[model samples]
Target: MPLRSLLRTIPIEPSPEGEKGGLQRRMGTIPLMMLGIGATVGTGVFFVMHEAVPAAGPATVLAFLLAALAAGLSALCYAEMASAVPASGSTYTYAYATLGELAAVIVAACLLLEYGVSTAAVAVGWSGYLNLLLDNTVGVSFPAILSANPWDSTPGILNLPAVLLVLLCALLLIRGVSESAKVNTAMVVIKVAVLVLFGAVAFTGFQADNFADFAPFGAAGVTAAAGTIFFTFIGLDAVSTAGGEAKDPRRSLPRAILGALAVVTALYLFVAVAAIGSQPWQAFSDPEQQSVGLAVIIENITGAAWPGTLLALGAVISIFSVTLVVMYGQTRVLYSMGRDGLVPGFFARVNQRTGTPVNTTIVVAVAVGLLAAFVPLGGLWDLVSIGTLVAFIVVAVSVLVLRRKRPDLPRGFRVPFGPVIPVLSIITCLVVLSGLGLVTYAWFGAWVGAALLYYALWGRKSAARARARD
Candidate 1:
């Protein structure tokens, strides 16, 4: 909170990239777009429909549209940060440079839940889709003991597929298997193809009566549903994060974030409409139906399961990529903190072999792996939403702070209407966060407290501030 320390961090100086510590900015516009698509259109599109539609009925489509607006607003603020500060640490670096160390530490905590736990949650969802695909296509499936996690609704011994996927991604990181923009684009194509195929098939079975009770739970339900559906919009930040590597970052950054928002929102709305039209809203909460909404809809329409099987396969592959991207984001944030002396310097240690922060990735893998292996997907998503909402709020505030603190600074992109736009972004985030239960806030508070304690005891003493002075 000291003014001098804050000014020191906020200067638009290029971070000193040591031969071992710097990230390679090899990404271009096309790959950047794919990163947005690949990260955005995963388990959320495949699975969140079941969760949202059931709560808001036919109105869930509106919820998806509304959530997109909120996400887009935050994305705009993020674009300015990314373009003005071309850093690899995403929100962590942005907050540190703008909001000071204490705020950065808090944002880091929220992001751990947002990106880390969300990876675990997505992995669990991917596992279900994987099992469904295998059962329908190959007539072989893992039994309950190996397939379901003990922390799920109807608990099983452990979730083998989910753990396996996490470990697989971890191994890839260890081996330096970076997911390029081309790969992201291909995954997006696969995800959209499967969903389009799903929408086409689902329409054939549409029943007008399925929407009889539109807005069944009224405004409260609509807001609650929006809060849950907001999780699907988490990847919108990928666009903002790309500002550092973007071509004509100021212009291209906004275009990409807004364009991705438009594309993803439309897709989600259409899918929601198709889902409610295909079956009654009440049936959505069924674990069997929710796990494979598109697949089940296809099977019901065709009276054969191949179409459903293929959809599940597409989900399995694309969602795996989502888990990887989310994990990558989480590790990079922690690595940034380490470099800043906010966490341990050990996390900042880049592997000489892979040019990655190897120890950091391992720590993340161990944490995420335990959650994916033992916890249920649904539990993780709510926590992810809370963390993401809080982080978005921080970015929104940072936008205003940076504008006021360094008005002379050259921003590649700027949010229009100055303070008004960011204020609205913060309000939208808070409204969404309000619907979360007390228990969620408790977990969030506990995590924040722990992070602060760590900082006070160790992080502050060994901070870059001390080292720089030395």
Candidate 2:
């Protein structure tokens, strides 16, 4: 295929008129937003505070704000695109409609990392909390060799709990979306309640002195912490992935996207303030305190084991939901690509009885499960942040391109300030992207290069045939 043909754009349909193979519209705004919250709250709140606090001290609160600002801007762009496109591929579908096939392929690559690796990362975090829960409740824990990744700080043979969590989520996803959504909603409530409880209890030990040496490592540290914390906000885009399955895409897409972002940001801020106030920021760095940071704080405050056990139980339960939501997003995106012939058709084969992409879910399950079992959480999280930031930048830029190229297209939601919002969104994502080190960029580049190579060698031919058939 010629370069121009390969870059050809997919038509922007006003509705699902010509989209014959689309998923069923079964989700409403509440479930959609719950999916986002389920995806967003788990890993970051439970695991990342330890990493961020050590980087920025009490100024980690500022880091949460900075990360939220960046995520919010990108989410605004996402809301617009989700409402307009209303497809399963999320940014990939948006890019295909606006930017072109090549840009869409690139966005798909970024999403593969964002959703797949993040699922693995979340599972790894879940493993830690599961161990914490078991230790507190049963007076026993998984052997280090079975519970920790080989490359983690506490090296082990494999992370068995992480792998088990991924398999369990895959089973639930294969059962169907509505069932998954119901489970996710319940998990969201549990996690949010525990976070609020932590805040209330932590407030009892609040100390103004914790803020006295805020930003001890200065501006650089704050930026670095924001970069680290950015992964927590990654699941906000999961709302857009459900557009095809949304009961009313036009209303539900924007409402769910923005609503999820607002709820997550508020909860994150509350947790951050309460956490730093409850204990000195410097203590977050102690290797012994890193794995179950929030529970430790609760233990310190109440001088009892029960409160810490409650938080650990919540973490174990809620993080499982996070893994399920993220893995679902990953499979749905792959299903879109498969339908478009960018990947093998196996992914597009939905189970008729359940109306779910069973094959795709299984594929994602095996791939993410392996990563969770072997890869270190720190590296997986950094890669997720880089992939997500780049994907957000592309989505923001696509909004500008779509407005200029096809202004007549009906949009359910539009960014309030036109180019200004998207431009700022792009800039904010770039700033966060810059904080990542050279190694992360190299890994991201290698992944993208491999994806493009596959596109050139296989996807191009398959996509051409698929388009010709349509």
Candidate 3:
């Protein structure tokens, strides 16, 4: 095939229309928004505070705001794409429609990092909190070999709890979307309530002194912290992927995307303020406390075990839901690619009875489960952040491309500031991307290169055959 043919664009039809077999539209605005919140509010809130606080001191609050600003801008672009495209592939589908097959393939690679690795990262965090809960409630915990990554300060043979959590969520996902959404809603409630309770209890011990040395490491630290905190906001785009299953997607997609972002940003800022106020920022660096930072802060404030224990319990439960939702996103994106013939047919095969992609879900489960079992949380998070930022950049660019290329297309939601919003979205994502180190970029480049190679040799031929057959 010629390069131009390989880079041909897909029409902007809904996934069901293009593929014939489609996902059920069982999700409304509430469940759609809940999925976003369920995926977004987990590891970042539960685990990132420890890393961010140490990086920026009390100014980590500012880091949260910075991250939210970038995420909000990208989400606006996502809302527009979701409204116009209304497909299951998220940014990949949008890219295929606006950019081309090459861009879509690249976006698929980025999303693999965003959703697949993120599931691993969230599960790792869940393992830590689960250990905290176990130590508090049962007076016992898994040994380092079973619970910690080999490279962690307290090295373990493998992270068993994280692997177990991934498998459990995978099982739940196989049950179906409505069941997953219901579980997600319940987990979101539990996690949000726990954060609210933490804020209320921690505020009692608030001290103004914690703010005196804010930004101790300077603006560089704040920027770097924002990059790390960006991990927490990664799931806001999960709303866009539900376009295929979203009821009244035109209206519900935008509302859910922006609504979930607003809720998550507010909660994050509130929790950051309460956490820094309740304890000195310098103490967040303690390795013993970092794994269960928020819970430890609550324990310090109340001088009791129960409040912290409850928070740990909430983290464990909620992060499990996060892993589930992210893994779901991964499968659906692969399903889209599979349908388009960019991957093997197994990925797009929806289970006849359940209306879900069971094979894709299983593939995602095994891959994510292995990463969770072996990779350290800190490194996993940085990789997720880089992929998310790049994918957001592409979404922002797609908004601009689609507007110029096909103005006749009816859009359910449009960015209020027109091109200015998308331009800023691109700039903000680039700014955050700059904070990631050279090593991360190298890893990302290697991954993308490998993916492109796979496409050149196998995916291109398969996709061309599929197109010719059609």
Candidate 4:
């Protein structure tokens, strides 16, 4: 293929709703907000502080703020592009429409880790929390063979709960957007209230001394901790994936993205403050505290078992929504690529009864379930972070390119201060990307290499065939 051909950009026309291969516009501002929250607030809130508190000390709250800022900047760019283009695929569609096919495919490659691997990882994590909740509430839990995979540290037959969780999410998704959004909204509400409950209970035991030695690691430590904390904001991009189905996307896309970010950031800070005040800062670094989480801190304060049980319930719900939204995002991205003939056409085929991409949802669910059931992806999380940062950079770059190339594009919301925010978004992402180890870069390189090879062997030819048929 000629370089010029690979550089060809997509036309601005988006398919109309309810048409073949097009999603229905049933997502209002509230459902979109719930989707964003559902994706963004996951098991991280339950466990991140144990790792972050050691580095930033009591100033881990500052690290949360810094991480949110990076996520916020990229989100602003996503809003602009989503409003301008109004499509299902997040960065892939934005990149194709602005930066061309080559850039779009590269973004698609990154998304495999961000959405695909992240979904499976969250599912596996959810399985552990499910057993924990069972053991807490009842006397018995699932046997080890059913709870873990053969390759895991403690080997087992398969991760049955993880696969079942993926199936339930897939069923909800296949039923249509309205049903999935409702379940996601309900899950988000439950998890949020659970955390709030923990905060309220933990505040009863607040100690003023915990804040005395704030920032024990100083500025460099805060910066390093921000890098560690940033990936918790990964689910924010899931909001942009629903652009094609958003009700009045020009207005709702920006609001939902910004709204979700605000809620997630405030929640993290609130929980961090409450957890730190409940016990000494140094206690968070203890190995036992890592697994017991905020629940343990509450248990220590209230001398009750119910709060820990409640938190375990929240942990299960937290990962469930994350898995659902991440899986949704992955399918929609593949839907866009499928429509463009970069992959199989069935991925883009919409079911008339449900008005959803049935084949795409099923295929994505099965793939994710298999990965969740047998593969251990917990150690490869840095790959998820790498992919997310790269995708955000692409989004920011797309905003810059579109502003220059299509200045008159009808964007519902624009990034404030012209190019400064978009440029800063790129620079901020690069700084976070720098924190990744060399091993991450090597893995990312190999991942991209495989994706490009697939494109070379079949993707371009497939697209050509589709265009000729049209």
Candidate 5:
């Protein structure tokens, strides 16, 4: 196991802008940043606040900063690597180009959980926001029997809305990247508008007393909350996966990645401060506010239904975009894996009409939909956090690997302070990763074990065959 088969890396030599038999490059810096924000700022802010706030009390604000530190450093590393290696597949591709085939495959497995499970988790959260919107405006909401998964607190047959959301996003992905990106950009606009509204209204009810018990649970609780909050930043790095589709991969990719991080961090802090200041952190644990976070906070703060209803509507729209972008990242990762012959060819097959990976999109939709429909959302995001943390570690490691191996590689962005920043990235990510519970570690270990087992038996052989043919 120490010395795996082949132990090779997929060659990465930048080619012309619009090479034949490749994904189209239509996205610029703005769209890419929107895509990242669309994916990064959704479920975490929308629903996970209840889960995160209760863990850190009013000091969840600190947790957000901690998670952001890890995310910020990782995004910088991602920018440098994506600029130097213009390839798709996010961490998987970057790791492969810098590390080896086995390492790439392992990262691909982590990405599967990061994007796919995150999509499912976001979809599940989406149903709650959707129900809140419906009940607020139309006087109807999905019954627990229809919206809650089997193992959720309110046991139900299945989460129908979540499965439906995944399917809809998949259909959009199959249509074309341009279409999806355009729609994501529009949703991001709507999302920002509603968040601004929430902040304004919530601040009117702000009380300084809320800060009295800010650190109730102490540093340990803050660390744990940071793990959950880090889940919100899962897709910030997804923008790097668009390297192959970016108009100027070298320049736009780095700017877009950093821009999205800045915007998302600012927005998250704004919302967190407003919500916490408006109400006691203990109120964050109220079951009703768990799924419908911002809306409930505004309603409790303003004593008006309109603001809450409006924010709920925005949550539905914004969360839809999040699920869409994360799903896109998931499919793209598989597409890149297929191109390297670690997976079936169907994954890499692009629809001539749409210029998108239709097969891959559909497969991801089905798999994620099943999970969204059946799996309970309890502690689900920890899985996403673990995966994202490890992948980020890999990115930081890849930066060092490439710098040492290919000092001559052209890079559009560079981490300031050289190895110091990358080293900090690794340390911050590790701290967050350690905050995850033993159950999450157990799950991650099993997943990584299975991936390595598959690699030892099948992936190694398939990749070898693919390399020989190439």
Candidate 6:
């Protein structure tokens, strides 16, 4: 037998109770779609436009399209895996069943940075907008000392709101506060409506000059900007992760994943196009316009505050919920790793009181909160792109491996073109990975190195390997 197959011989099966933990299967197709939108449409749509537009100029629309294409391909692969192996472990569990224990460990490590750090980044970004909303609408603002990060361009002592928000979400999750399918469907509707409103209002100020100097740095710039813009597309996998709770795993999972992808991509492209036409792309870099780029265009177009205020208010509400869902995903991924004995068992301990993993939630919440409080979102964005790039690459490869190893395994959703699709998916992910900056690679290396060292010295050696051997 192959060495990889030998590793699989060990039966480190999960305890049936923890396996069937009361985490209800209440998420259906509609709720799953909402979760995807909730997790995805937050900081990326509201905040990333300012950063991405200047890089790609009016071609920001094309950048959104390209990112969605790549994300769509990956999402299709994810749908197949999720339906084939319905579970809560996300990509880590999928990798374990199809690959081996070692590959699962590496994928889990990638996810730690992908989901955990992204949670910190989104929460921190949300804090900035929340502050903006308070100052403009409520006439209340926290001092710079408490509202900004100490390490920011204009340093503040701490970011109090960001920290508090993380804690709030943690408390909610511990009580098993899940968004019902109906509620999720409603949120998706609200999110779509708000973005459409922003696009319509912003389009009234459309100007032709913004297209001048399109692709300022040529294709390289578009690719680089896409790397940044890719964060907007991260939660497309929100479709796959809901497989266990989906109504018709085969039909609904694929349609929901593809439908959400199509809708989000169209909306994002519309926003990008509308924003570019509303102003000179260079104006995107103006600091005053960064927080509410679309809103600023509305203010300029209609010469009114109501539209801007409304957009900002929508952002504050929607982004808060996005932070909650994404942070919840991060905690659950860690919980799965902990349960597998690849990390501290403390992370897997479910609270008897609420029947949720309270301690783990707190640990993840505090760490992410501190990062959000002290580090600016700019510092966190590149790392999020890199971590996600690596994880997606792994999933793409896993799809191909599973096809060859277990051809008879039933897959509810299969990628078209067989090996060709998986191969293209892997290549596309790597191409995007290459576009990432040197600093992103450095940060990614440090994170992966840390996880591997922990695994080598502790997790791999002291993990359930010992239990399985005995």
Among these predictions, the greatest lDDT belongs to 4
Task: Give the Å error, residue 417, model 4.
Answer: 1.3
Q: What is the lDDT of residue 194 in candidate 5?
A: 84
Candidate 2 C-alpha lDDT tens digits along 126-239: 887888788878889889989988887778999999999998999999999999999999999988999899899999999999999988999989988988887778788888
Off by over 4 Å in 6: 1-18, 47-59, 153-155, 180-187, 203-228, 242-252, 276-291, 351-355, 375-377, 465-470
lDDT of 3 at 172: 86
- Using TM-score, give the best candidate's number: 4
User: TM-scores of all models?
Assistant: 0.86, 0.92, 0.91, 0.97, 0.90, 0.86
Error of 4 at 209 (Å): 3.3
Task: Give lDDT tens digits, candidate 4, residues 1-470.
Answer: 79986998877767546345468888988999899999999988888989999988999989999989988999899888878888889999999998888888899999976788889988998898899889988878889999899998789999999999999999999999999999999999999999998889888988889999999999988988888788788788898999889888888988899899999999999999998888888898899989787888888888877877898899899999988898899999999899888998988999888888989999999899999999989778889888988999999999998989999988889999989999999999888778789999999999999999999999988877876786
Q: Which pairs clash in the backbone of model 4?
A: none
After superposition, the stretches of candidate 1 with alpha carbons farther than 4 Å from their true spots are: 1-10, 15-21, 54-57, 148-158, 175-181, 203-224, 239-253, 276-291, 351-354, 375-380, 465-470
Between candidates 2 and 4, name the one with more favorable lDDT. Answer: 4
Tens-place lDDT per residue, model 1, 1-470, is: 35554334534555323223544444555566566766788766777877887789888877887777778789888877776766667777778788877788788888887888788877887777888888877888888788788766667888888888888777766665244454556677877888888888888889999888889889878877887777677787766554334555555655666677777888888888888899888878889987665677778888895876687777887887787767767777877777777777788787766666788889999889888888665755567778888888888888888888888877768888878888999999887777789998888888899988887777766775645853
Candidate structures ordered by TM-score, highest first: 4, 2, 3, 5, 1, 6
Q: Over the stretch 306-340, how does candidate 6's per-residue lDDT look in tens digits?
A: 86667767776676767777776777677767766
TM-score of 3: 0.91
Q: List the global CA lDDT of all models.
A: 0.75, 0.86, 0.86, 0.89, 0.86, 0.73
lDDT of 4: 0.89
Count of clashes, each model: 0, 0, 1, 0, 0, 0
Worst 10 residues of 3 by lDDT: 13-22
Provide the RMSD of all predictions against the true structure, rounded to 1 decimal. Answer: 3.5, 2.6, 2.8, 1.4, 2.8, 3.8
For model 4, where is the 10-residue window of minimal lDDT?
13-22
Least well predicted 10-residue stretch by lDDT in candidate 6? 9-18
lDDT head-to-head 4 vs 5, winner: 4
